[model samples]
Target: MSLLSMTKTNLKALFHGPYTSQFPLKAREPFANTRGHIDCDLSTCIFCTLCDKKCPTGAISVTRSVKATDTTPEKKGTWSIEPLKCIQCGYCVETCNKNSLIMKGECSEPATENVR
Candidate 1:
Protein backbone atom coordinates (compact mmCIF):
# COMPACT_ATOMS: atom_id res chain seq x y z
CA MET A 1 0.00 0.00 0.00
CA SER A 2 2.80 2.46 0.84
CA LEU A 3 4.67 1.59 -2.37
CA LEU A 4 1.53 2.18 -4.43
CA SER A 5 0.99 5.59 -2.81
CA MET A 6 4.63 6.59 -3.44
CA THR A 7 4.35 5.58 -7.10
CA LYS A 8 1.16 7.59 -7.51
CA THR A 9 2.78 10.67 -6.00
CA ASN A 10 5.86 10.33 -8.17
CA LEU A 11 3.77 9.97 -11.35
CA LYS A 12 1.65 13.03 -10.42
CA ALA A 13 4.76 15.09 -9.84
CA LEU A 14 6.30 13.99 -13.15
CA PHE A 15 3.24 15.11 -15.14
CA HIS A 16 2.78 18.38 -13.17
CA GLY A 17 5.77 20.14 -14.75
CA PRO A 18 7.71 22.68 -12.71
CA TYR A 19 5.99 24.20 -9.69
CA THR A 20 8.09 27.35 -9.77
CA SER A 21 8.61 29.85 -12.54
CA GLN A 22 11.93 30.27 -14.38
CA PHE A 23 13.37 33.20 -12.47
CA PRO A 24 15.90 34.58 -14.96
CA LEU A 25 13.83 33.96 -18.06
CA LYS A 26 10.59 35.22 -16.58
CA ALA A 27 10.77 37.37 -13.49
CA ARG A 28 7.89 37.21 -11.04
CA GLU A 29 5.77 40.28 -10.44
CA PRO A 30 6.27 42.09 -7.19
CA PHE A 31 3.39 42.24 -4.72
CA ALA A 32 1.37 45.43 -4.23
CA ASN A 33 2.88 46.32 -0.84
CA THR A 34 6.32 44.84 -1.36
CA ARG A 35 9.06 46.89 0.28
CA GLY A 36 11.66 46.46 -2.43
CA HIS A 37 14.02 49.41 -2.37
CA ILE A 38 14.26 53.18 -2.03
CA ASP A 39 14.90 55.44 -5.00
CA CYS A 40 15.82 59.11 -4.91
CA ASP A 41 15.11 61.85 -7.45
CA LEU A 42 17.93 64.33 -7.21
CA SER A 43 16.23 66.98 -9.34
CA THR A 44 13.55 67.86 -6.80
CA CYS A 45 15.62 67.12 -3.72
CA ILE A 46 16.32 70.01 -1.33
CA PHE A 47 19.28 68.52 0.55
CA CYS A 48 17.13 67.85 3.60
CA THR A 49 18.52 65.23 5.97
CA LEU A 50 15.13 63.83 6.93
CA CYS A 51 15.60 60.60 5.02
CA ASP A 52 19.03 60.02 6.53
CA LYS A 53 17.70 60.60 10.02
CA LYS A 54 14.62 58.50 9.44
CA CYS A 55 16.55 55.48 8.18
CA PRO A 56 16.49 52.89 10.97
CA THR A 57 19.58 51.12 9.66
CA GLY A 58 21.55 54.31 8.96
CA ALA A 59 21.86 53.23 5.31
CA ILE A 60 21.05 56.62 3.87
CA SER A 61 23.53 59.48 3.61
CA VAL A 62 22.84 63.03 2.49
CA THR A 63 25.63 65.49 1.87
CA ARG A 64 25.19 69.18 1.21
CA SER A 65 27.70 71.03 -0.95
CA VAL A 66 27.83 74.78 -0.62
CA LYS A 67 29.81 76.95 -2.98
CA ALA A 68 30.41 80.50 -1.74
CA THR A 69 30.62 83.30 -4.22
CA ASP A 70 31.00 87.05 -3.99
CA THR A 71 27.27 87.69 -4.24
CA THR A 72 25.64 84.55 -2.84
CA PRO A 73 26.12 80.88 -2.06
CA GLU A 74 24.98 77.94 -4.14
CA LYS A 75 23.76 74.85 -2.35
CA LYS A 76 23.87 71.38 -3.81
CA GLY A 77 23.32 68.02 -2.26
CA THR A 78 24.06 64.36 -2.93
CA TRP A 79 22.03 61.42 -1.67
CA SER A 80 23.47 57.94 -1.48
CA ILE A 81 22.28 54.64 -0.08
CA GLU A 82 24.06 51.51 1.07
CA PRO A 83 21.94 48.76 -0.45
CA LEU A 84 23.35 46.02 1.77
CA LYS A 85 22.61 47.89 4.98
CA CYS A 86 19.18 49.17 3.93
CA ILE A 87 16.24 47.41 5.54
CA GLN A 88 13.75 48.75 2.96
CA CYS A 89 11.32 49.85 5.65
CA GLY A 90 10.04 52.78 3.51
CA TYR A 91 10.61 55.18 6.37
CA CYS A 92 12.92 57.32 4.25
CA VAL A 93 10.33 57.57 1.50
CA GLU A 94 7.64 58.72 3.93
CA THR A 95 9.87 61.19 5.74
CA CYS A 96 10.87 62.98 2.54
CA ASN A 97 9.02 66.29 2.47
CA LYS A 98 10.20 67.16 -1.06
CA ASN A 99 8.73 63.97 -2.52
CA SER A 100 12.13 63.16 -3.91
CA LEU A 101 12.17 59.69 -2.47
CA ILE A 102 10.27 56.87 -4.14
CA MET A 103 9.72 53.23 -3.20
CA LYS A 104 10.39 51.13 -6.25
CA GLY A 105 8.48 47.92 -6.69
CA GLU A 106 11.40 46.10 -8.31
CA CYS A 107 14.01 44.66 -5.99
CA SER A 108 17.51 46.06 -5.96
CA GLU A 109 19.98 44.37 -8.30
CA PRO A 110 22.74 42.11 -6.99
CA ALA A 111 25.74 44.16 -6.05
CA THR A 112 29.38 43.42 -5.44
CA GLU A 113 29.87 46.53 -3.33
CA ASN A 114 27.96 47.87 -0.34
CA VAL A 115 27.61 51.46 -1.59
CA ARG A 116 25.37 52.43 -4.48
Candidate 2:
Protein backbone atom coordinates (compact mmCIF):
# COMPACT_ATOMS: atom_id res chain seq x y z
CA MET A 1 0.00 0.00 0.00
CA SER A 2 1.06 3.61 -0.67
CA LEU A 3 2.17 5.85 2.24
CA LEU A 4 -0.64 8.35 1.57
CA SER A 5 -3.38 5.69 1.64
CA MET A 6 -1.98 4.15 4.85
CA THR A 7 -1.81 7.54 6.60
CA LYS A 8 -5.34 8.44 5.51
CA THR A 9 -6.73 5.13 6.72
CA ASN A 10 -5.09 5.45 10.14
CA LEU A 11 -5.99 9.14 10.62
CA LYS A 12 -9.60 8.70 9.45
CA ALA A 13 -10.14 5.73 11.68
CA LEU A 14 -8.84 7.61 14.74
CA PHE A 15 -11.07 10.65 14.02
CA HIS A 16 -14.11 8.40 13.47
CA GLY A 17 -14.10 7.68 17.23
CA PRO A 18 -13.89 4.53 19.30
CA TYR A 19 -16.42 1.69 19.53
CA THR A 20 -16.38 1.94 23.35
CA SER A 21 -17.63 4.62 25.71
CA GLN A 22 -15.63 7.41 27.34
CA PHE A 23 -13.92 6.16 30.46
CA PRO A 24 -14.33 7.68 33.98
CA LEU A 25 -16.38 10.60 32.62
CA LYS A 26 -19.26 8.38 31.47
CA ALA A 27 -21.22 5.72 33.35
CA ARG A 28 -21.62 3.11 30.63
CA GLU A 29 -24.42 0.58 30.67
CA PRO A 30 -24.30 -2.92 29.26
CA PHE A 31 -26.94 -4.30 26.88
CA ALA A 32 -30.37 -5.10 28.36
CA ASN A 33 -29.57 -8.82 28.33
CA THR A 34 -25.80 -8.77 28.21
CA ARG A 35 -24.25 -11.47 30.38
CA GLY A 36 -21.00 -10.36 31.97
CA HIS A 37 -19.96 -11.43 35.46
CA ILE A 38 -21.29 -14.22 37.64
CA ASP A 39 -21.96 -13.46 41.32
CA CYS A 40 -23.97 -15.41 43.84
CA ASP A 41 -25.89 -14.42 46.96
CA LEU A 42 -24.21 -16.32 49.80
CA SER A 43 -27.24 -16.18 52.11
CA THR A 44 -29.57 -17.99 49.69
CA CYS A 45 -27.17 -20.82 48.83
CA ILE A 46 -27.95 -24.24 50.39
CA PHE A 47 -24.57 -25.89 49.65
CA CYS A 48 -26.21 -28.14 47.04
CA THR A 49 -23.10 -27.99 44.77
CA LEU A 50 -25.34 -27.96 41.68
CA CYS A 51 -23.84 -24.73 40.44
CA ASP A 52 -20.27 -25.88 41.12
CA LYS A 53 -20.87 -29.10 39.22
CA LYS A 54 -22.39 -27.32 36.23
CA CYS A 55 -19.55 -24.79 35.90
CA PRO A 56 -17.45 -25.83 32.85
CA THR A 57 -14.45 -23.74 33.87
CA GLY A 58 -14.34 -25.06 37.44
CA ALA A 59 -14.14 -21.48 38.56
CA ILE A 60 -16.74 -21.86 41.24
CA SER A 61 -15.61 -23.40 44.52
CA VAL A 62 -18.31 -24.26 47.07
CA THR A 63 -16.85 -24.86 50.48
CA ARG A 64 -18.85 -25.95 53.51
CA SER A 65 -17.79 -23.85 56.47
CA VAL A 66 -19.08 -24.19 60.02
CA LYS A 67 -21.62 -21.60 61.01
CA ALA A 68 -21.27 -19.62 64.24
CA THR A 69 -23.78 -21.15 66.65
CA ASP A 70 -23.69 -21.91 70.33
CA THR A 71 -25.92 -24.99 70.22
CA THR A 72 -24.57 -26.88 67.20
CA PRO A 73 -21.97 -26.70 64.43
CA GLU A 74 -23.70 -26.82 61.07
CA LYS A 75 -22.25 -26.50 57.59
CA LYS A 76 -22.98 -23.33 55.67
CA GLY A 77 -22.40 -22.52 52.02
CA THR A 78 -19.27 -20.63 51.05
CA TRP A 79 -19.15 -19.90 47.35
CA SER A 80 -16.05 -18.46 45.73
CA ILE A 81 -15.34 -17.66 42.08
CA GLU A 82 -12.11 -16.87 40.23
CA PRO A 83 -12.77 -13.97 37.87
CA LEU A 84 -9.81 -14.76 35.63
CA LYS A 85 -10.93 -18.33 34.97
CA CYS A 86 -14.65 -17.76 34.49
CA ILE A 87 -15.93 -18.19 30.91
CA GLN A 88 -19.11 -16.15 31.58
CA CYS A 89 -21.32 -19.16 31.00
CA GLY A 90 -24.78 -19.00 32.60
CA TYR A 91 -24.95 -22.72 33.24
CA CYS A 92 -24.09 -22.35 36.93
CA VAL A 93 -26.79 -19.73 37.43
CA GLU A 94 -29.37 -21.79 35.53
CA THR A 95 -28.68 -25.06 37.36
CA CYS A 96 -28.77 -23.45 40.79
CA ASN A 97 -31.46 -24.96 43.02
CA LYS A 98 -31.78 -21.66 44.84
CA ASN A 99 -32.24 -18.46 42.87
CA SER A 100 -29.17 -16.95 44.54
CA LEU A 101 -26.69 -16.54 41.70
CA ILE A 102 -26.99 -13.34 39.64
CA MET A 103 -25.17 -12.26 36.49
CA LYS A 104 -23.99 -8.68 36.96
CA GLY A 105 -23.07 -6.76 33.81
CA GLU A 106 -19.92 -5.22 35.23
CA CYS A 107 -17.34 -3.41 33.09
CA SER A 108 -14.30 -5.39 31.90
CA GLU A 109 -11.74 -2.56 31.85
CA PRO A 110 -8.56 -3.04 33.81
CA ALA A 111 -7.49 -0.42 36.32
CA THR A 112 -5.03 1.74 34.40
CA GLU A 113 -3.32 5.03 35.24
CA ASN A 114 -2.91 6.12 31.61
CA VAL A 115 -4.71 9.43 31.18
CA ARG A 116 -4.30 9.59 27.42
Candidate 3:
Protein backbone atom coordinates (compact mmCIF):
# COMPACT_ATOMS: atom_id res chain seq x y z
CA MET A 1 0.00 0.00 0.00
CA SER A 2 1.07 3.60 -0.65
CA LEU A 3 2.18 5.83 2.20
CA LEU A 4 -0.84 8.12 1.86
CA SER A 5 -3.25 5.19 1.88
CA MET A 6 -1.47 3.62 4.88
CA THR A 7 -1.62 6.93 6.77
CA LYS A 8 -5.32 7.29 6.02
CA THR A 9 -6.00 3.74 7.16
CA ASN A 10 -4.07 4.24 10.37
CA LEU A 11 -5.90 7.51 11.06
CA LYS A 12 -9.27 5.83 10.57
CA ALA A 13 -8.26 2.98 12.84
CA LEU A 14 -7.08 5.41 15.54
CA PHE A 15 -10.28 7.49 15.45
CA HIS A 16 -12.60 4.48 15.31
CA GLY A 17 -10.50 2.61 17.94
CA PRO A 18 -8.89 -0.79 17.61
CA TYR A 19 -10.85 -3.66 16.14
CA THR A 20 -9.83 -5.90 19.06
CA SER A 21 -10.20 -5.52 22.77
CA GLN A 22 -7.42 -4.02 24.90
CA PHE A 23 -5.53 -6.85 26.49
CA PRO A 24 -5.45 -7.33 30.31
CA LEU A 25 -8.81 -5.49 30.51
CA LYS A 26 -10.70 -7.95 28.30
CA ALA A 27 -9.39 -11.37 27.33
CA ARG A 28 -11.03 -13.65 24.80
CA GLU A 29 -12.02 -17.13 25.89
CA PRO A 30 -10.25 -20.10 24.39
CA PHE A 31 -12.10 -22.14 21.78
CA ALA A 32 -13.88 -25.35 22.74
CA ASN A 33 -11.31 -27.54 20.98
CA THR A 34 -8.32 -25.33 21.67
CA ARG A 35 -5.47 -27.05 23.48
CA GLY A 36 -4.05 -24.43 25.80
CA HIS A 37 -2.11 -25.72 28.78
CA ILE A 38 -1.52 -29.05 30.45
CA ASP A 39 -2.10 -29.81 34.12
CA CYS A 40 -1.42 -32.92 36.18
CA ASP A 41 -2.89 -34.26 39.41
CA LEU A 42 -0.06 -36.00 41.23
CA SER A 43 -2.29 -38.03 43.56
CA THR A 44 -4.23 -39.59 40.73
CA CYS A 45 -1.22 -39.98 38.47
CA ILE A 46 0.28 -43.47 38.43
CA PHE A 47 3.63 -42.13 37.10
CA CYS A 48 3.39 -44.45 34.14
CA THR A 49 5.65 -42.17 32.00
CA LEU A 50 3.17 -42.25 29.14
CA CYS A 51 2.92 -38.46 28.95
CA ASP A 52 6.69 -38.09 28.74
CA LYS A 53 6.81 -40.57 25.94
CA LYS A 54 3.92 -38.95 24.05
CA CYS A 55 5.05 -35.34 24.20
CA PRO A 56 6.31 -34.36 20.74
CA THR A 57 8.44 -31.46 21.96
CA GLY A 58 9.81 -33.34 24.96
CA ALA A 59 8.37 -30.70 27.24
CA ILE A 60 6.99 -33.17 29.73
CA SER A 61 9.41 -34.70 32.20
CA VAL A 62 8.73 -37.76 34.37
CA THR A 63 11.44 -38.76 36.80
CA ARG A 64 11.15 -41.98 38.79
CA SER A 65 13.21 -42.55 41.93
CA VAL A 66 13.01 -45.32 44.47
CA LYS A 67 13.01 -44.34 48.11
CA ALA A 68 14.63 -46.71 50.58
CA THR A 69 12.06 -45.97 53.27
CA ASP A 70 9.16 -46.65 50.93
CA THR A 71 8.63 -50.31 50.15
CA THR A 72 6.22 -49.80 47.28
CA PRO A 73 6.75 -52.07 44.32
CA GLU A 74 5.90 -49.32 41.84
CA LYS A 75 8.33 -46.43 41.60
CA LYS A 76 6.84 -42.93 41.86
CA GLY A 77 7.99 -39.88 39.96
CA THR A 78 7.29 -36.18 39.69
CA TRP A 79 5.78 -34.79 36.52
CA SER A 80 6.61 -31.43 35.04
CA ILE A 81 5.84 -29.71 31.77
CA GLU A 82 7.99 -26.89 30.42
CA PRO A 83 5.60 -24.31 29.01
CA LEU A 84 8.24 -22.66 26.84
CA LYS A 85 8.83 -25.75 24.72
CA CYS A 86 5.30 -27.20 24.76
CA ILE A 87 3.38 -27.06 21.48
CA GLN A 88 -0.02 -27.73 23.09
CA CYS A 89 -0.64 -30.71 20.79
CA GLY A 90 -2.65 -32.61 23.46
CA TYR A 91 -0.70 -35.77 22.75
CA CYS A 92 0.05 -36.28 26.42
CA VAL A 93 -3.60 -35.84 27.33
CA GLU A 94 -4.63 -38.56 24.87
CA THR A 95 -1.95 -40.91 26.16
CA CYS A 96 -2.70 -40.50 29.86
CA ASN A 97 -4.79 -43.50 30.98
CA LYS A 98 -5.25 -42.33 34.55
CA ASN A 99 -7.01 -39.10 33.47
CA SER A 100 -4.55 -37.15 35.60
CA LEU A 101 -3.43 -34.97 32.75
CA ILE A 102 -5.84 -32.26 31.62
CA MET A 103 -5.77 -29.46 29.08
CA LYS A 104 -7.01 -26.19 30.52
CA GLY A 105 -8.55 -23.33 28.53
CA GLU A 106 -6.00 -20.75 29.61
CA CYS A 107 -2.46 -21.02 28.29
CA SER A 108 0.78 -19.95 29.89
CA GLU A 109 1.31 -16.21 29.79
CA PRO A 110 4.45 -14.58 28.38
CA ALA A 111 7.45 -15.17 30.56
CA THR A 112 11.15 -14.35 30.54
CA GLU A 113 12.34 -17.45 32.34
CA ASN A 114 14.04 -20.17 30.27
CA VAL A 115 12.91 -18.44 27.10
CA ARG A 116 14.93 -19.56 24.11
Candidate 4:
Protein backbone atom coordinates (compact mmCIF):
# COMPACT_ATOMS: atom_id res chain seq x y z
CA MET A 1 0.00 0.00 0.00
CA SER A 2 2.84 2.39 0.87
CA LEU A 3 4.65 1.56 -2.37
CA LEU A 4 1.50 2.26 -4.39
CA SER A 5 1.02 5.66 -2.67
CA MET A 6 4.66 6.60 -3.28
CA THR A 7 4.39 5.70 -6.93
CA LYS A 8 1.19 7.73 -7.35
CA THR A 9 2.80 10.78 -5.70
CA ASN A 10 5.92 10.48 -7.81
CA LEU A 11 3.90 10.23 -11.01
CA LYS A 12 1.78 13.24 -10.08
CA ALA A 13 4.87 15.31 -9.30
CA LEU A 14 6.56 14.21 -12.53
CA PHE A 15 3.67 15.58 -14.63
CA HIS A 16 3.17 18.67 -12.43
CA GLY A 17 6.47 20.27 -13.47
CA PRO A 18 9.00 22.01 -11.20
CA TYR A 19 7.73 23.87 -8.13
CA THR A 20 10.51 26.47 -8.21
CA SER A 21 11.37 28.86 -11.00
CA GLN A 22 14.68 29.06 -12.85
CA PHE A 23 16.50 31.47 -10.57
CA PRO A 24 19.28 32.52 -12.93
CA LEU A 25 17.05 33.06 -15.93
CA LYS A 26 14.19 34.69 -14.06
CA ALA A 27 14.88 36.59 -10.86
CA ARG A 28 12.32 37.06 -8.11
CA GLU A 29 10.84 40.47 -7.40
CA PRO A 30 12.05 42.38 -4.40
CA PHE A 31 9.76 42.42 -1.36
CA ALA A 32 7.91 45.51 -0.23
CA ASN A 33 10.12 48.01 1.60
CA THR A 34 13.20 45.92 1.02
CA ARG A 35 16.32 47.56 2.33
CA GLY A 36 18.77 47.26 -0.52
CA HIS A 37 22.06 48.99 -1.37
CA ILE A 38 22.93 52.67 -1.07
CA ASP A 39 23.67 54.87 -4.07
CA CYS A 40 25.05 58.39 -4.22
CA ASP A 41 24.35 61.17 -6.73
CA LEU A 42 27.58 63.10 -7.07
CA SER A 43 26.01 66.03 -8.93
CA THR A 44 23.70 67.09 -6.09
CA CYS A 45 25.98 65.94 -3.30
CA ILE A 46 27.84 68.54 -1.26
CA PHE A 47 30.16 65.96 0.31
CA CYS A 48 29.10 67.13 3.75
CA THR A 49 30.24 63.87 5.41
CA LEU A 50 26.90 63.54 7.24
CA CYS A 51 26.27 60.14 5.71
CA ASP A 52 29.72 58.93 6.77
CA LYS A 53 29.16 60.03 10.34
CA LYS A 54 25.71 58.43 10.55
CA CYS A 55 26.78 55.04 9.22
CA PRO A 56 26.76 52.56 12.07
CA THR A 57 29.10 50.13 10.31
CA GLY A 58 31.46 52.78 8.95
CA ALA A 59 30.67 51.70 5.41
CA ILE A 60 30.46 55.27 4.03
CA SER A 61 33.50 57.44 3.40
CA VAL A 62 33.55 61.07 2.26
CA THR A 63 36.63 62.96 1.14
CA ARG A 64 36.08 66.64 0.56
CA SER A 65 38.43 68.86 -1.38
CA VAL A 66 40.46 71.28 0.71
CA LYS A 67 39.40 74.30 -1.29
CA ALA A 68 37.24 75.16 -4.29
CA THR A 69 38.79 77.62 -6.70
CA ASP A 70 37.35 79.42 -9.72
CA THR A 71 39.58 77.41 -12.04
CA THR A 72 38.64 74.13 -10.35
CA PRO A 73 34.90 74.76 -10.20
CA GLU A 74 34.08 71.09 -10.51
CA LYS A 75 36.37 70.01 -7.68
CA LYS A 76 33.90 68.94 -5.03
CA GLY A 77 34.92 65.72 -3.29
CA THR A 78 34.84 61.95 -3.51
CA TRP A 79 32.12 59.86 -1.92
CA SER A 80 32.42 56.13 -1.75
CA ILE A 81 30.80 53.22 0.03
CA GLU A 82 32.12 49.79 0.91
CA PRO A 83 29.27 47.53 -0.16
CA LEU A 84 30.62 44.56 1.78
CA LYS A 85 30.55 46.49 5.05
CA CYS A 86 27.14 48.13 4.53
CA ILE A 87 24.30 46.71 6.63
CA GLN A 88 21.51 48.40 4.59
CA CYS A 89 20.34 50.28 7.66
CA GLY A 90 19.23 53.34 5.61
CA TYR A 91 20.66 55.70 8.19
CA CYS A 92 23.10 57.10 5.70
CA VAL A 93 20.32 57.87 3.27
CA GLU A 94 18.32 59.62 5.92
CA THR A 95 21.25 61.70 7.13
CA CYS A 96 22.01 63.08 3.68
CA ASN A 97 20.87 66.71 3.79
CA LYS A 98 21.30 67.20 0.07
CA ASN A 99 19.21 64.09 -0.72
CA SER A 100 22.15 62.79 -2.70
CA LEU A 101 22.03 59.37 -1.06
CA ILE A 102 19.45 56.97 -2.40
CA MET A 103 18.39 53.50 -1.27
CA LYS A 104 17.94 51.39 -4.33
CA GLY A 105 15.35 48.61 -4.36
CA GLU A 106 17.54 46.21 -6.33
CA CYS A 107 20.15 44.37 -4.31
CA SER A 108 23.87 44.75 -4.77
CA GLU A 109 25.58 42.32 -7.09
CA PRO A 110 27.95 39.63 -5.86
CA ALA A 111 31.55 40.76 -5.67
CA THR A 112 34.72 38.91 -4.79
CA GLU A 113 36.56 42.13 -3.97
CA ASN A 114 35.38 45.19 -2.03
CA VAL A 115 33.46 47.56 -4.30
CA ARG A 116 33.65 51.31 -3.84
| Model 4: CA > 4 A from native | 1-16, 70-74, 114-116
Model 2 Cα lDDT, one tens digit per residue, 1-116: 56576887789889999868787779777886788888788667777788888899898888665554422213464677877778887888889878888887884455354557
Tens-digit lDDT track for model 4 on 41-78?
88888888999888999999998887655223257788
After superposing candidate 3 on the true structure, give the runs of residues whose Cα lies further than 4 Å from its correct spot. 1-18, 67-75
Clashing pairs in 3: none
Q: Give the alpha-carbon lDDT of every model.
A: 0.84, 0.76, 0.83, 0.85
Q: What number of backbone clashes does candidate 2 have, counting pairs of residues 3 or more apart or in separate chains?
A: 0
TM-score to true structure, per model: 0.76, 0.65, 0.70, 0.75
Misplaced by over 4 Å in model 1 are 1-10, 66-75, 114-116
Among all windows of 10 consecutive residues in model 1, the one with the lowest summed lDDT is: 66-75
Which of candidates 1 and 3 reaches a greater TM-score? 1
> Which tens-of-lDDT digit does each residue in 33-98 have in candidate 3?
778888998878877798998889999999776665643424466788888889988889899999
lDDT of 1 by residue, 6-68 (tens): 888789999999989998999999998888888998878877788888889999999876653
